[model samples]
Target chain A: MKIDKSLLTGSTTMLILKLLEQSDMYGYQMIEELEKRSQNVFTLKAGTLYPILHTLEQEGRIESYTKEIPSKRPRKYYMITKNGRKLLDEKKAEWQFYATAVNQVLGGEGYVGV
Target chain B: MSECNLLVKEFLNITCEEIKAKRVHKQIVNELSDHIEEQTQYYIKQGFDELTATKKALEQMGNPTIVGKELNKAHQPKTEWSIIVLTFTLVIIGGFIQYFVSRANSYNSHAFFRFLIYAPIGLIAFFCAYFFDYTIIKIYSKLLYSALFISTIIGFVFINRINGTYLYVYYSAILFIPIFAGIVYSLREKGYFGIILCGILYGGVAILCLFSVRTIAFLLLSISCLAILTFAINKGYFKCNKRIGLSIIYTPIFLILILSVYYILSAGHRRERFATMFNPENDPMGAGYLSLLIRELVGNSQPFGLSQLKGSLANMKAELILPAYNTDFILTFVFARFGYIFGVIIIALFIVFLARIFTSVLKQKNKFGVLISFSACLAITIQFALYTLSNLGIIATFSVTLPFISYGGLGFITNMLLIGIVLSVYRNSNIIMESL
Candidate 1:
């Protein structure tokens, strides 16, 4: 299914934070991994991924470090902080609540007895 | 193994062109270039030729202008509005205080008007310092330090004192302290030798002030400079043993403090002033006069409205007036004329102002920015503390002007310049790299 870009915009931060929550990652790695996990349904552009990562780092939610491997160009890696983890959990809860509410309104299987 | 292709280079250029902080352009370009290369490799392995794969990779990266605009938004220089607002509020309040001072002293009748003139000039100075990059101090630290040193010697040879106080030299010392932070930063790579070099620079200030016979300036300059050096050492910027660095930094301060105590004890007049500082009532007619007057004024002060003077204070009020009421003693004047509440509010305002400046210091990512902002903070903080103490008669009276509140042109302009440099440091905080 092709998701509208606008639909994914608001969730990009949460998705990026979710990826970092798994392990430290570089920009390309995060994009490739996100796409692979989504079965290639979500191909995050490099332009979109970096700005979110840089903004998160600025807010102290995550931090970046340069790791130089032998005979390879040094890569800038970002890891989630305690604050980033907390944010991710809240984002997860919020996303779940939001998805459940939308499904209920649409009269889907997510409907519950209120 | 190969050079970057022209198409990739052109795309990188367009992306980085949108980033206002040129300092971070290289890093961002490198990161983005790496992304494109990785994407290209993936495509090449999937059965595409190199040029076609690179083009495909670029297509996936999205438009350069949009990416660059977003990155620029992230790296934009942070202007600290809170500090700016607090500073101007204090400056306007200072204008009111100067007006009160003008009403009390005939010789200072023009003081308020002078401040009115200096205000716009101060604003210009503030913006000039704010917009200008302060890292240039790192490039010319040695030359600037030597220039200040030589100028101080020359100042001693010509204009030494105004009304028997070393005001000119003292204000110059206040201006030099912030610049000294840059010198300390420039020497960070020298290790222990850097500590020694800083010590020598500080020693030179002490010796210059000693020979020039300006003890107060020497005290203010040496103490504030030492604080910056100690801060740098503790932050491990000196790249030397912390304990050894601290010991090296403090040994001279300790020796100087002891020498000052001895010097004061050996002089009868200085000893009398020092002794009367403890008990102003003992010498109410002489050395304790100002202290006693300050205490009487503060003691009679009401909370909300103006306090009515009584007893000795009332009698003295009719016959004698406070000297420097417009300059150093403005805080006491505020308490005497307005209320303790007014004085407390002013002090609280200063506390907020200092807090704002300190917050900027914490936000700084670059070492040079940290040191510059911190040194400015230290200088202003010392002045504010000493001026308040002196005004309240808790310490012997000296010629220290309260930062942004005192009635002096040079002190006002110098303080604005310092705050400007701090704001400038904050403006470039995110853009500058951490390494240099």
Candidate 2:
């Protein structure tokens, strides 16, 4: 499925922060992991991912450090900051509220009552 | 596979071409290259042919220009806004002062409008310098140094000597400091050859200033060079004892030679300036007249100042009193009209502005940025101090524009340009810190 950029735009940083909450990951690893977890519902271009990563790093919500993997290459690994974790929790709550509103408007009140 | 490698380089090159930070470029290139290599290997191990693996890896990385633009957005050099906003404020206030002072005179509205034009032009000059890529100095250090050198020598023919002071042309000499710093930094690996070449270029300018009558330029240039060398030493550029010792020996000796020449050239009114600085009585009617009156007026003007009196600012101007009040003696207009509080506020802002400059310099990881920023900061600080002291009748020898505050032409532009370079350095400096 082709995911519109707008669909991912608002929550991309949140997704990144949540993924990073599990373990520190480099660019290629995060891209692959997101593809696997989402079951290919979202195919993020590498171009789109970097600016979001950079902006997150600049905002102090994430920090990157280069580590050399043996027989491979030096890769920049990013980890979520304490602030990023707090932000992720808030974003999660907001997403839940947003999802509920949309579901109700779309006649899915059956699940809500149950 | 070789073709694939070329493809990787070309893609990364296009992706990062817009990004100017040396460290960021290398970092991104390495990251992208490694990812491509891994992807290529993965495809090959999956039974794809080498050509197919390479092609697939390149395709998956995405479009170069789009990626480059995205990366550029992140890496866009941040202009130091506090300085920009503060400088703009000061320029506006300076325009106000000029307008009010000019309007104070009954018939003359000329200076008021002239200042209106100069303010915007000065700001544009600043932005131009700020927006210009500062790395050009590093990339073409030798070329920049050579161009500034030729200009300084050529500067002599166009000296704008007004009221017994050579103020023009030599202002270009200030450009020498940063360009030379860029040289030393770029050629730092070349060891003694670089240091000697740097010294020779500096010595040439210092020597020119030594013989010329532009004492302000001579003083500003020498002091700025001292600041750059000190910063380089502190930043570990001259880590070896030999370089440090050589600079120590060469710098003071060079300064002494300049000082001796200045002393020798300090004949006529120049020598009289030093002789009458403390005791205005010695040459009270001669060179000491203006300084003596300045001291008396400032002393009598209390907390608020002479402008508190009816039409005193206009009165001072219309009566054709206080020679050159708009030019060399500009601070008198500020203090006499606005009062001591305003004068001190102006001084405080200068200090704050300088602090902003130094703080930015401290953040620069690269030695070239640090050195160039330091040179500019030192030049402005020294000029500000000397100009303030001279305005207060402490030292009559130093006559310079009070940076963005005072009114002048080329001198003001040069100072603004220097500030712009500092801004450029600051704008480009943030991305190099690496964690162990």
Specify the highest-TM-score model's number.
1
Model 2, span A1-114: residue lDDT tens: 676879887887778888999999988778778888999876666667777887677666788887877886668899988978888999999999998888787766575675
- Whole-model Cα lDDT of every candidate shown, in order: 0.84, 0.73
RMSD in Å for candidate 2, one decimal? 7.2
- Can you tell me the DockQ of model 1? 0.58
Error of 2 at B125 (Å): 1.6
Q: What is the DockQ of candidate 2?
A: 0.42
| lDDT for each residue of candidate 1 in B227-291, tens digit (9 for 90 to 100) | 89988998999888999989987787689789989999999988887888788887989878888
Docking class of 1: medium
DockQ values per model? 0.58, 0.42
Residues B26-121, model 2: lDDT tens digits:
877877787777778889999999879988877887888888887777776677888888777777777777787677775446767877777677
Candidate 1 stretches greater than 4 Å from native: A1-7, A68-74, A102-114, B1-4, B162-165, B255-273, B304-307, B310-320, B433-436
Every model's TM-score: 0.89, 0.70
> Which residue pairs show backbone clashes in model 1?
none
